[model samples]
Target: MTPMLKHFRYLSTSGIPRPFRSIPGPLSLPLIGTLYKYFPVIGNYKFSKLHINGMKKYKQFGPVVKEEIVPGVNIVWLFDPKDIENMFRCEGKYPKRRSHLALEKYRLDRPNVYNTGGLLPTNGPEWWRLRKIFQKGLSSPLAVQQFIPGTDDIVTEFIERLSLIEGQNAIDFLPEISRLFLEMMCLSVFDIRMDSFSDNELYKNSRSTRLLKSALTTNSCILKLDNGPQLWRYFETPLYRKMKKAQKYMEEVAIDLLSLKMSIFKDRDENSSKSLLDVYFSYPELDFKDIIGITCDFLLAGMDTTSYTTSFLLYHLAINPRAQENLHKESVRLLPEWNSPVTKEVLAEAQYAKACLKESHRLRPISVGVGRVLDQTAVFSGYEVPEQTVIVTQNQVSCRLEQYFPRPNDFVPERWLKDTPLYRQGHPFLLLPFGHGARSCIARRLADQNMLILLIKLSRNYKIEWKGGRIDTKSLLINKPDGPILLKFERYQC
Candidate 1:
């Protein structure tokens, strides 16, 4: 073996002290860490073992375990809810741990949209400032209420499109739902419609959207391999060129939309009510580029997460018909009709539906977990985690711990029902689907409300079932069904 390979093998096998011995599960091979075992197994959708195997590791290694994949870096996998809370509590100081290879290769070259001051990517004061601004836009109860109609229209169209599918067909629901959700996000955030469903040049050939997807996909893969280039070289690559073009396209669209809105604002009577764009424009701190960055942030965040969660829920429901039956029955009893707005009370009443969503998220979080880098040396679980050490809190494993959840593997929504200890005692940090700390998703409430509306409408219209009595999941940025969710929709006889 080469000298570097020999060093990597020694670090993987013998660098750690006996007390911090390697956990009993998959064997870590020379220079490759656990990738050699995990990659092949997870590459197949039918036999993907990452989630299950990771959970097993947590059970064996306790809440905090260190794995030395390379000579200098030690990946500390944290599983306890308390530890997660502590990590998040240190938010600004403990910013997202930098991934040298992936971040440089895919993220740095991109214009600020993918790199925007939004919750997921930014750090320190910049992140806080953007989060504050976004929260102001998203927090207005009146503004959110105003968005309901637009969101409903989008979901209604989604239902209409789904109705056209033939009987007992296996179809991939990811792309369709993603497109619809992206449109909805655009409508709500920009107060303009892209109509992604109908062919439009902007929607069909959106260079920014395509580039954003590519960058995220490439980042995810390369980060896992730690094969990123140096900072200066990253900006000069072909990938970087694509990212820049995508950002430019996004900026052009944003500027045009902003100009149109500004004109309307000028034309309106002095007493006319302000829209979201009007409110956004009133803020002097934001420029055209900032606006474009935030807009792209909303689109990217909404599309992948909503579509993935929806797909995973469908996958679980497809496999567990009884859960689906219960959810449908609850949804029907609460809403009884699809034409009306879903009231807070009615949503609360759909206990099983909410449970199923939580259960799905617990099993398969869209991004898996959050990452943070220690700004100062800190001791965790009696081990000294030095400054700049990357801490990854595994949401999949943390949610499945028997202490926090009973029958974690099984599908049970009752855990979240009223008056239950599980409901009361569940740590908010542990149950974070939108992440935690100051950088959590700004559009979370809006997303949840829209999702609930879609579920109600879908349950009222169709009886979803698996094709050939089975469903499988595939991951490409977001976890989704390998094929579309196919079911027969009989018009509800009310």
Candidate 2:
């Protein structure tokens, strides 16, 4: 029997779907809700082990779990693909989801520096407006295609740098990948090469390192404040203060980059094609502060998402030699020579490469899942959920379950390819790496192009091997690798 048929054999959706109240989850008290369940000694769940906790919840609750995470704020977690589809379908024209409350508070506290809470936190009309402008040049395939040459240029330089440390015992590639993504994002968003890979004393203390450090600091701070109590809301907590300092540095750097780009725009020929930054600048709806906010948002969003995803992708390739060889075969077929320029046409034929990425995403998604606050009421698993209720889709859990993908724990890229016998025609919403719908990731195309080009180039050059312990994820607002990504890179011989 086929994997799809096998998947069907495990199906147990019997009887009528339970009501909203019947959705199983941990107990919730009046003021603290289910917050006590995560407290020390008394609590069963650990905030650091949220990903593990999600798996435990799935086993206990059987797909649909609802809990009031905080007082008066109830969240319905959907692990079933069918219910995930229902949740998204209920998302109206302006799909709304809860943002980083701490980040929003930070932005709102400083009205002069930020016009809105940026893209990740803002909702309603402001989000719609920003998203529309963001989609102008960043969303389209062709738009990202324009940067293929530039992205490949950065990747080629990075691969050459990797060659220097080829024979190292175990290379901690997370930092290496982080630097590569930073350079790529700089070239794509700012139309400038950060040259972060260059071994220069000046580069060490320059804007690139500073910006990356600030971003990391801010991410750590936000994670600490978001998961815990609302202590930051009451006063400037130490972590909050540190985040503000890092954010302040980020704001200064963004304004500087904006100024630099604007000055360059003044002298450039009108016939020259506009860059992503130029496209944002052209939008009259946004002012200077808004541009700064958007630039900062892109910087923050681009850094970790693609870099972390690439790290896991490489890890998957490292441990699974068979899969890596298959990818190497695909890369060798398309890229005849090392440092071959990755063009839009070449990427079109790299199906296996794309499948490898999809498989990696299935295993190590950047976030546990995407969440939404529906505009209208919807029925999920026959439960009549109310409007404006936050519905979090447990995609991380579902994607790994046998019910959706057969041999879900194994790294098998063939499952994503239709011609393979191992393929399962699973639910369309089973794997949402870039998410779905209008309110999905704004830089989805750009991130994909960036990583695809890098993967193709890397596979053609080196055979990745992992000789370390299993790397898992730790939830930090978003999912991040729990430990260092240690790998060995040996130059491939023809």
Best by TM-score: 2
lDDT (Cα, 0-100) at 244 in candidate 1: 45
lDDT of 1 by residue, 242-326 (tens): 4445545545566676777778766667564445666677799776656666665565466667876787677677667787778
**Model 2, residue pairs in steric clash:** none
What clash count does candidate 2 reach?
0
State the displacement of the C-alpha of residue 475, model 1, in Å, after optimal TM-score superposition: 5.5
TM-score of each prediction: 0.78, 0.93
Please, what is the whole-model Cα lDDT of each candidate in the order they appear?
Answer: 0.61, 0.83
Off by over 4 Å in 1: 1-53, 68-71, 92-119, 140-143, 166-168, 199-265, 268-276, 343-350, 419-424, 468-488
